[model samples]
Target: MKKAVGIDLGGTYIKAGLVDENGKIIKKQQFPTLAEKNDREIVLTQIEKSIEFAFEDNIEGIGVGTPGVVDDEGIVYEAPNLPCWDKINLKKIFEEKFKKKVVVENDVNTIAWGEYLFGAGKGSKTMICITLGTGLGGGIVKDGKLLRGGKYSAVEIGHIPIDYKGPKCKCGNIGCIERFVGRDYIVERAIKGIREGKKTKIYELVNGDLDKITPKTISDAYNLGDEFAESIWIDVGICLGAMFSGLVNLLNPDTIIIGGGISQAGKILFDTIEKTIKERAMKILSRDLKVVPAGLGIDAGIVSAGALIFQE
Candidate 1:
């Protein structure tokens, strides 16, 4: 059985695993990113160590899921999360260091591919994987192939403009859906509500420490029937669904798999998203589309990365 090594490089940690063609992770290891070291060489070394630990031997290739724009040649153009990585040639470094074939792709793309091949989208011919977290990232797969547009950055649904003059996005755009529905936006709205003395359970949950308020905290507050938090999630769902409506019209995918930290909100998130999409999307386009949550969870990156090398 041929095996592959998969690495998901993030700002805070590096997760690597040995995975088989069946999407089964045989071995796994993790380590801190140590990005502040300010040297790409050091970061690459740590990554190699994690890969080595995960795969003792017999790895056909290594696949890396990075947090930024990556060219088909496996070069990272920019990684906002990891400031140390800027236009780094990740594929060359890994291949030279380990003498193994390497494949590098954007982290969200990896996750989307993983889901399409082995998770919720296993049997779908066309699918869109949208991850809602710190920022919204997406990948679109058409007929089992990942779509890389002109700049190898297609399906960047998060940046799709919803409002012409809304809030500013980190991408320097105005009214991008990401600015309104991203994890930070969700938490920010909740914190604002609390600060305004909205009599809600969120105040009790965070104990006045607004800094500790996270998307998860807001989700928990929503589950506890906090009206303000619930409203925030509803708005997030509506925004996401509205964005997806355009995708539904364009691709008419069999599934749209929603993933990432905020997805853990479960029905509170999905219900609203589904409702909004149904109300907004074209009837024919949405009739058969399934909007589902991702199954791979945190392992999505590693599994998807491995698929880059292992999938037929």
Candidate 2:
């Protein structure tokens, strides 16, 4: 079978995998990206090492998924989290060394493409794929194709304004969906509640350490019958639903896939979002659109990167 090498580069970790042309991952490995503590050369070295771990003589091509604004030719203009990844010609660098066809794209787009070709979105013609983690990232597939705009920076669904008068966003906007539902935002909400003396299981789990009140702690609290934790998750769900309601009214996608670590809150989180979408979205769109969690689990990054080649 034809083989390929795929890389998923993130702020915290870099995952590399060997995949068959059929979209099945044959082998996978990871390394700490240390994107912040390291310079461009160091990070590139880490990537090189990961590729070495997964490399085989017969690999046909290489595909990389980066969390940044990547041009069609695999140049990264900027990575939001990794400060050193500015204006890097990742494709040229890797191809010069590996002598293989290399393609690079935004991480979210890779995830969406993986789903489109091999996972939950396999049959959908139009879909919205979201990953809720340190921040929200999204990719839109319209009419069975990735919607890359003129500058390869379209469908950044997370930056959409949810509350015009709310907090300032990193992108210089006010009250983006990420501002409401991102992991840091969620933790901040929990911290605010703790400071205000709103008691929950989160405090016990974190042992009164406010900084330790993570999303998992909150989800755990909700699972353990803490009303305060439930409220927090529900609030984020409402924000997500409200935002998607607007998306449904505008783009009318057939499926919406939610992934990333934060989405593991399971029923408590999903139920509220689904309820809000059904109540607020266009009737036809809500009735027809299927909103669900991702199917690729932790393998998404590698599989999705591999998909950039197969789907092309």
- Give per-model TM-scores: 0.95, 0.95
- How close to the true structure is residue 232 of candidate 2, measured as C-alpha lDDT? 94
Estimate, for each residue in 1-312, the C-alpha lDDT of model 1 and write its tens digit.
878999999988999999998899998878988898877778988998898887645788998989888876777876887888988888998888888888888889889889988899888989999888888999988887888877655567889999997988888889999999887788889878877878877778878888888888887888888888889888888988888898888888889899888889889789898888899999988998888999887688888899889655
Each model's lDDT comes to 0.86, 0.88
Local accuracy of candidate 2 as per-residue lDDT tens digits, 113-185? 8888788888897898999999899988877788887877567888999898999999899989999899999
Pairs that collide, model 1: none
RMSD of 2: 1.6
Candidate 2 off by > 4 Å: none
Q: Give me the runs in candidate 1 sitting further than 4 Å from their true place.
A: none
User: By summed lDDT, which 10 consecutive residues of candidate 2 come out lowest?
Assistant: 146-155
Clashing pairs in 2: none
lDDT of 2: 0.88
Q: What is the lDDT of residue 61 in candidate 2?
A: 83
